[model samples]
Target: MTKQGAGQAGVGQRWTAPQRWTLAAAVLGSGMAFIDGTVVNVALSALQRDFGADVGSAQWVINGYTLMLAALILTGGALGDLYGRRRVFGLGVLIFAAASGLCGLAPTLGTLIAARVLQGIGGALLIPGSLAMIDAVFGDALRGRAVGLWSAATSVVTVLGPVLGGVLIDLGSWRWVFLINLPLALLVLWCLRGVPETRAAGEGARRPDLPGAVLATAGLGALTYGLIQAGERGLGGSSLLIAGLGVAGLAAFVLWEARAPHPMLPLGLFRSAGFAGTNALTFLLYGALGAALFFLPLNLIGVQGYSGTAAGTALLPMSLLLAGLSGVFGSLADRTGPRPLLTVGPILAGVGLAWLGFLGVGRPYLTGVLPGVLVLGLGMAITVAPLTSAVLGSVSADYAGTASGVNNAVSRAAGLLAVALFTLLMLGSFRGSLSAQLAGTSLPLTARAQMLGQSGRLAQVPVPDGLSDAQAAEGRQAVRLAFADGFRQVCLWCGMLAALGGLVGFLSLRGAGRGRQGGGAGENLHEPRGEEIRAGQAAPGRR
Candidate 1:
C-alpha cells in the first residue's frame, strides 16, 4: 500500500470518475450505519409488544448498539489507518450486513440485543473509515465541498431509514427493518472495488493500543449497564459501584493514552481549540438529537394514537430540509469559516426542541409538529457539514481517520449517556404524574397499586380488568397524559444540551477556518510552520 494520498488518481482531482465512485462508496457505506441507528427507534413499540419487554428492556435494544460503537470507534479508526481504509471498510460492511440478518432472525429479545451489539462493532469501523477516505482523497481546496455533499447525501438517506422501517413494521414485520441492510451492504462492497487502499507512513511497524481499547470498552460498557440498571431499579449500591468503576476505567484509559508508545487516539489532537470545541459541540448536540428523537416515535404511537407509518411520515419535513440545505452550508463554511454557523445552528435547534416540549394530545400535526421539525432540521443542516470540515481540517491528512473517529466517539458516547440518563428522568416524571392522575379517579386501592406496579410500561400499561367503561376510559387517558409529561421533560433537557453546544463552539473556536491544519502528528502539537506542513506526508513515524 502507498502512503496516504501519494499520487493517487483521485488525489487533488475535481469530480473525476474515481472521485465520484469513492464518494458514492463512502456515502452508501456510512448511510447503512446511520440508517440502522434511527430505523430501530421506529420499530421499538412493536419490539416491546412482541417480546413482552418493559421500558428498561426496550432501551437495551438501542443502548446495546450504541455502547460498542462509542467504545471501539477510536481503535477502528486507528486500524483503518494502520491496515487499509478500503479493506477495513469493506470488512465492516460485511460484518454489519451479517449482523443485521441475525437481528432479523432473532426469536428472542436477548438474541436481538446481542445482534445489535455486533452491528455496533461493525458501525465503529466503517463510519470513520468512510469519512477518512474522503479527507485523504480530496485536495485541501476541494475537501470542504466534498464533505458537504457527503453530509447532505448521508443525511437524506439517514432519515429515510425511519420511513422505510415504519412501512416494513406496518405492512410486514419489524424483522424486515434489519433485513433491509443486506442489499445496501452488497452495493457498498461492490463500490469498494474501485476505491484505492491507503494507510499511514509506517503501518506495519506501529502497534495498536490494545490495553487502551480494553479499558475504553470496559469503561463505557460498565457506565451504560449501570445507568440502565438505575433506570429500572432506581439508584442502588450495586449500580453506583458499577458506575464508579466505569469512571475509574475511563480515567485509566486517558492515562494510558498519554504514555502509550503508539496511542490509538493521539491526545495531541485535542490541543487545537477548533478540534476540542467541535467535539464538545458534537457531544452535546448529537446527544440531545439522539435521546430526544428516541422518544418521539414512542410518544406518537403509544400516546397520540398514530400508526407506525403515519408517525414516520410526520418527520419527513426534517429530512427534506437537511437534504436540501446541507451542501449549501458546507460550501459556505469553506468561504466564511465555521465559527458563526456552528454557534447559531445549535442554538436554533435548541429553540425548536423547546417548542416541541410543549406539545400535548389532540394537537394537529401541521401546527404542532412541522414547524419545530423544520427549524430543528435547518439547524442541523447548518451544523453537520461545518462540524465535519472543522474536525478534519484541524489535523493533517495522515491522522484523518483518528480525528473523525474521535468526533464520532464523542457523539456516540453522548447519545449513550443521554439515553440512559434521560430514561431515568422520564421514569420519575411518569411515575409522579401517573400517581396524581390516578388519585383523581374512583379506582379501588388494589387496582391502583397494580397500575402503579406496571408504571414501567409507560403508555402501554393496561387498564385494570372488571372496571366500568367510564373508569377504563379514564385509566387509558391517564396513561397517555403521564407518558406525555415524561416526554416533555426529556425534550426540555435535550433543548438545553443543544443550546449549550452552541455556547461551547462560540467560546472555543475563534478564527477557525476550513483550510488551516491546526496540529499534525502528536509530536508536533503546536501549529505547523510552512515547511513542516509541506513535509507532513514524509514524517518518519506514526504519532
Candidate 2:
C-alpha cells in the first residue's frame, strides 16, 4: 500500500470505532424497550395461568406498562433535556434492568403488574434519550445516517420480539421473558460509557411538569381499570366510580397543561390543522392495528390449536414488511407526498383485516391467514414512514420534540383504549351468543355454568371437564364458534375504523407528499431521518 493509502486507512479506523459503539448502544437500548413490549404479550397467557389471573389482569399486565409509558414519555423527554441526556439515559437502563428482574421474580399477578409499571417508567427515560443521544453526538452532516442505522437495527429486534419470546416460553417458564432483558440491558450500559452527556444549554430553570405526569398516569390507570372491570361486573358501583375519577383526572390534566408555564404537552402544537389531522388519523389507524395484534395470537393458539412458538412466528411476514419495505415506502413518499400514501395504506389495511374477519373456526393458515397477513403487512409498510414524515414535518423545529412526543402519546393511548373497549364488546357479544346458542342446543346445567364462568376469557377459555368424547367435541365446537363470533365482530370494527382513518387522511391532508407540500413548513423536508421517524411509527403491539 502507498503511504497515503495507509494514512487514510488509519483515519478510517479511528472514525469507525466510536461510531460503531454509539450506534450499537442506541440500537440495543431502544431495541430493549421494543423487544420487551412484544415479548410480554407472548407471555400474557402464561401469566394468566401462572398467577391464576383472569383475563382482565392479563390486560392490566400489558396496559399498565403502556399506560405509564404513554403518559410519562413527554415528561421523560423533558427530563433528559434538563438533566444530562446520558445520565438520565443510564439511570433508565439500570431501572429497567432491575424492574425486569423483579418482573421475572414476581410471585403474584399484582406483583407482576407493579413491576411492569416500573419497567414502563424506565422505558420512558430510555426511549427518547436513546435517539437524542445520537442527535447530540453525530454532526448535522452524519446525523441522519446515524439515526437511520439505529432505526434499522432496532426495528429488526422489535419484529423479532414475539418469536424470541415464543422460543423462551416454550423452552422454559414465562419468567424468562422478563429475565431475557438482563443481558441486553448490561450490553447497553457498557456501550453507553462512551456516549458524552448532552443537555439543553439555556433552559436551566425549566422543571419537568411533575403534576402533569402524575395526573396523566392516574387518569389512564383509572380508565383502564374501570373498563376492564366492566367486562366482568358490568357498569356497577366500583367501575362507575373509578371511571368517573378517570374522566375528572384527565380533564384536570388537560386544564393544567394548558395553563402551566412549562408544560410537558404543549397545547399550542395542536394549532396546526395539518398536525392535528395527521395525529387524529394516527390514533384511528393505530387503534385498529392494536386490536388485530392483541387478538391474533389468541386466534392462532387458543382457538386454532397452534403452539406458542408457531403462533408467534405466524406474524413474521407482517413484521418483515414493516421492517424491510418501510424504507422503500419512505422513498416513494419523498417523490409523491404523505397524503396519497396515507389514504391508500389504511384502506388496504382495512380490506386485509376484513379478509381476516372471514377466517372460519378452523381454517388452513396459508389459505385463510397468510394472504391477509401479507396484505396487512404491505399496507402498514406504506403508511408508517410517510405518516411519520407528515407528523414531524408538520411542526417547526422549535416545537418538533414536543410535537413528536404528543403524536407518540396519541399512538400509545390508541392501543390502550382500543384493547379496553373492544375486549368489553367482545365479551358482551360472546356471552349473549354463547347463551343463545347453548339455550336451545341442550348442554347440561354444569357445563352451562362452566362456560358462563369462562365467558369473559373468550378464546382462552378452557375446555371443560367431565364430558365424554362426543360431548366434549360438541362443547369445543360451541365454544370455538362463540369465540369466533366475538372475534369477527371486533375485526369488523377494526376494519371499519382503519377505513375511517384512511378517509380522514384523504380529506384532511393535501394531495401531495410532505416532501412536496412541506407540511406547512414551506420547504421540502425529505431525508434519512424520515426512515427513523417513520419506522418508529410502529408501537410494540403494532404488528
The most accurate candidate by lDDT is: 1
Off by over 4 Å in 2: 1-18, 440-442, 511-543
* Model 1 residue 36 lDDT score: 80
Q: Superposing all C-alpha atoms, what RMSD in Å does each candidate have to the true structure?
A: 7.0, 4.2
lDDT of 2 by residue, 1-543 (tens): 665565455443434555667678878988888777676766766676666566776877778778877798878878888988888888888999999999999988888889988998998898778877787776544555677678778777776778888888888988998998999999999998777778877863278999999999888888878888888899889988888898899999999999999988888877766688888988898888777677777677667877778877887887788788887997888788788988999888888877887776889999988888888888888888888777777777555666677778888877887888788887898888777766655568788888878877766666578877877777777777787788888888998898899998888786434442233343222212222223222333531
Q: lDDT values of the candidates?
A: 0.77, 0.76
Residue pairs that clash (backbone atoms under 3 angstroms), model 1: none
Q: What does candidate 1's lDDT look like per residue over 364-438, in tens digits?
A: 888887788878878877877777777777777766656766776777778788877888898899999999989
Q: CA shift at 385, candidate 1, in angstroms?
A: 2.2
